[model samples]
Target: MNDTTTFKQSLTINLRVIGALLMREIITRYGRHNLGFLWLFLEPMMFTLGVTAIWSYTHANHLGSTLPIAAFTLTGYSTILLWRNMPTRCVSAVIPNLGLMYHRNVVLLDIFVSRIVLEVTAVTASFSTLGILFFSSGLMKAPEDIVPVLIGWMMLAWFGASMSLFVGALGARSEVIEKIWHPISYLTFPLSGAAFMLEWLPAPARAVLIWMPTVNCCEIIRQGFFGPMVHAHYDMSYVAIFNTCLMLLGLAQVRLVAERIAPQ
Candidate 1:
């Protein structure tokens, strides 16, 4: 076969491999019982709803903000799930699926991609469902601008997927990564801009926190949701540049791990 034909064939096979992996992952994780795969989105939805309820009960929006409490919590917690769950699911991902590596078509990248795709799809579904429910019930308002919300969400997915790939690859080399990551994830949750808007913080703290890509992503999403009612601080170019670098590093690390673990 010519080089072009060979490349096309490989690409087609890899796509099939990824699809199969996705199905297996869903069945294995969700099973075919009560709600089954529906739980994928429902799980995140319930968590977001619970958080919104707690915030409402405690009057978490007492910061002189005009945004609805339901909308604020939904947007904030949904973004948190997008970035947090992906990496958590991906860490030490390869070891559990190592048996599948015996199949020529199943690659390490496929495993990570399948998990990341699953998490992103689940979180996005949860966000959309809750948004619709809240709007209908008059608990939240329709977003002022959906374009930025979509852009911000896509950026967050990229950030999460890249970070998961890097973390998962490194995890194959050492178990310590998984241990260290748990605490770090918890510690960073408050600063991730999921619980508050950038405008709520003083100038000095806001300046430092804006450096986190997830924080910028939350700001972009909130800007879309609340519009001029809130001041959103973010630099899209900076986010794009950081995501690019991280993605490159992740791909390189995955390649290294694949070589190391390749069957003799």
Candidate 2:
């Protein structure tokens, strides 16, 4: 077979499998619970609500120049959680769901795609409800631009997925990764885009933070929702480049891990 033709066929087959896995995950995950799909939407809402309440109480007086509390907190908090959850969930996916991979068809991509699908579903339900409720009530006016925001979201998602896959693959073999995860998570908060916005951070700290690709994800996404008021500085290209590298690394790691890890 021609190499090009073979590659195309492989791609096609992969797409078919991905689509099937997404459907399967959605049905099985939500179907098992009585609340079912409601949980998907509710997870984000409750998460957002809890964060918003805590922040509003502490940062009530500090609006960060001209940014509104609701708009700033929503985008920043949601995007932060989005990136953070990817790796955490992905790491857990392998061990817990190993039984499903007994079939040859369930590859690493299946796990990655499944996690991404569920994450997207949760975010969609949450952010969609949030936007509608907030906008309808006149909480946020309108976005100045949406293109950069979208680019940021896609990059962040890719970053999260890639990083998670890499770590998950490592965890599959060593089994040591899961042990440090609690400390890793705790140490992650300061650097995470959730705790502070680009505008609010001190000049030096903000400059340092801009180097972190995850920060760009939240910053650009927040800018998309809040515009100039939130005061965000992001480099989408930076995130895109890092995400590409991470994804490749993760893909390679997954294959390696699979060779050593027999499906349970």
Candidate 3:
């Protein structure tokens, strides 16, 4: 076969492999239980809603005049659910599926990508449903600009997928990586722009925190959600450059891991 035809055939086979992996992952993770795959969306929604209720109740008097605590908490926590849970899901993905590698078309990259796709889809659906529910119930206003919100959501998903790939590969190579990532992921939660907004932070802190891609994404999302009512600070260029570099590094790591796992 010619080079172009070869490439196309390989691409088609890989796509089929990825699709099969996705279905297997969904069945493995969320089997035909109570809600089955529906739990994928409900799980995150429940977490966000629970937190929002507690925050709204306790801080009933303290929620700012500008943005309702429900709206703020929902936006921030939903984004957290999107980016935070991914690495956790992917950290041990390859080890359990190592036997599947015997199949010529099933590679390490396919395993990681399938898990990441599952996570991003779940969180996006959860976020969309919550936004609709909150707006219709009069708990929050509809977003002024959905385009930027979606762009920001995509950026966060990119960050999560890249981070998961990098960490998942490392975890497969070393038990130490798996141990360290658990604590590290917890520590990152507070600093991940989930609990507060960029405008609420002090000037010096804001300058430093904006360096986190998650923070920039949260700010961009809030800018769209709140519109003129609140000021949000973010740099899309920085997010783009950082996620791109991280994605490249992640792909390299996945390639290395794949080399180690290649059949003799």
Every model's TM-score:
0.96, 0.86, 0.95
Which regions in candidate 2 have their CA more than 4 angstroms from the true location?
1-13, 23-33, 57-59
* Model 3 agreement with the true structure over 1-264: per-residue lDDT tens digits: 899999999999999999999889888888988888898889999999998899777875333555788788877998998888889888888778988999978888999998898899999998999888998999988888998899999999999998998999998888788888989988999889877787887899999999999999998898888889878899999999998999899899999999887543
lDDT of all predictions: 0.92, 0.75, 0.88
Residue 112 CA error for candidate 2 (Å)? Answer: 2.3
What range of 10 consecutive residues in model 2 has the weakest lDDT sum? 60-69
- CA lDDT of 144 in candidate 3? 87
Error at 222, model 3, angstroms: 0.2
Residues 109-166, candidate 2, lDDT per residue (tens digit)? 6877777767866775677678677778887766678787677777877887888888
After superposition, the stretches of candidate 3 with alpha carbons farther than 4 Å from their true spots are 60-65, 262-264
Note the residue pairs that clash in candidate 1: none
Candidate 1 backbone overlaps, count: 0
Top-scoring candidate (lDDT):
1
Model 2 / residue 51 / CA error / Å: 2.2
Evaluate model 2: give its TM-score: 0.86
